[model samples]
Target: MTLTHNRKPDESKTAVLAVNVGKPQALPGQKREVMSGIVKHPVSGPVFLSFTGMTGDAQADLEHHGGPDKAVCVYDYSRYAALEELMNRKLDWGACGENLTVEGCREDEVRIGDVYELGEATVQVSQPRQPCFKLGARYDYKELPVYFQDSGHTGFYFRVLQEGEVAPSAVFRRISTDPASLTILDANRIMHQGKQDSMGMRTLLAIPTLSDSWKQTLLKRLTKLESEQQG
Candidate 1:
């Protein structure tokens, strides 16, 4: 199934936001941050952002070095409908990446592998974040992961397609599905019921990117079960 949001373009009806760097040791700025890229959530809205300072060496270091996993980014959804709770908090405890500080969004509606168009940049959704220790360390909230999962607010990665400036009030459009509708929720169901051959289940495990622990187990069980049934 596919879903689309077609809205009339009006200042009062549309919202576009980008993640801007926060003030030194403070919350992020409340203006249009020049857009470099965006972070996606499986069941939530997108976080928009812009990068600052760092140059060639520093950029490489950031992506390939130790700080890559812990670097949190930010986006502003103050214009998007449904999200308005994430504004001005010292420590937003949900997705663990040191990426963006954000507010105003129901971040869970977007799923892993979905495609989004922001300004001129297009991004492919990757996966829901599995939180780590840095998040708790930054905010002293051990239950941050629990809350994020419970709230279904997660973000995925997007490969930069067309780089351009993105800011608050920018409207996002979903162009495609995640190739098989394989959600973590669906994986859990397949594991519990051992229903590997079901239509949706088959489609999910079909994706090579999704063939992890659960899919492996499911395939093994499926093979064994198939053999027994034939016998």
Candidate 2:
């Protein structure tokens, strides 16, 4: 069950292009304040990442975002091209509200509990980011969240293992991976697409590396399903 990538990550292949952080701001045409750090600009020097998130980053909605497990939002640089094609427009690196715009690793390659040495900081993959309606609001496209979810290109989050500074062009080296084969992509599928598969849900629930928030949400869904059946 231990899956290993025998090859080391090539520094030239994997790198951080931008480190962006933002505070809460009022969305255009909306009265509510949203901490949609999606419009991040590149920082020239090292930025510190703590257990919660990048030093300057803040989340307005604590109900769903920004905790130890949901900290350090990461998006693949490769997916930008696909997203641009879908939206038929050019987008910036931090357009997805990611703290780090990363290259080389994609959702499929990153598994839950996979740890990486990112610059001076160490981070572990926590879960696939569930796109929210705020994304659509940011783009002014109401269907964007649905499109993002269905595209399966949803970026992932990281839990800071070792708080340290990270700069642009920093390389990420995979330190280790969980023995369970539940990848971020697989976890996303189980959460978003495989609702009818009770067996799959049970198996996902058993994985020790799965995020506690995700487990709780799945448990609620299962309970609701059971109640409905009994009703």
Could you tell me which residue pairs clash in candidate 2? Answer: 38-97
lDDT of 1 at 16: 36
- Please report the candidate that would top TM-score against the real structure: 2
Q: Listing every candidate in turn, what is its Cα RMSD in Å to the true structure after a full C-alpha superposition? A: 11.1, 6.3
Query: How far out, in Å, is residue 79 in model 1?
Result: 15
- Candidate 1's TM-score reads 0.45
lDDT of 2 at 153: 79
Q: What is the TM-score of each candidate against the true structure?
A: 0.45, 0.88
lDDT of 2 by residue, 1-231 (tens): 222222333435667777888887767865676555555666788888889988778887888889999888988877776666666777776888888888776878888889999989999988899989888888778788887687677989999889998888776778898766577778888888988767778878887767789999899888887788889
State the lDDT of candidate 1 residue by residue for 77-115, as single tens digits.
322222222322322221233232233322334444555
Off by over 4 Å in 2: 1-12, 31-35, 227-231
Ten-residue stretch with the least lDDT total in model 2: 1-10
Q: How accurate is candidate 1 locally (lDDT)?
A: 0.39
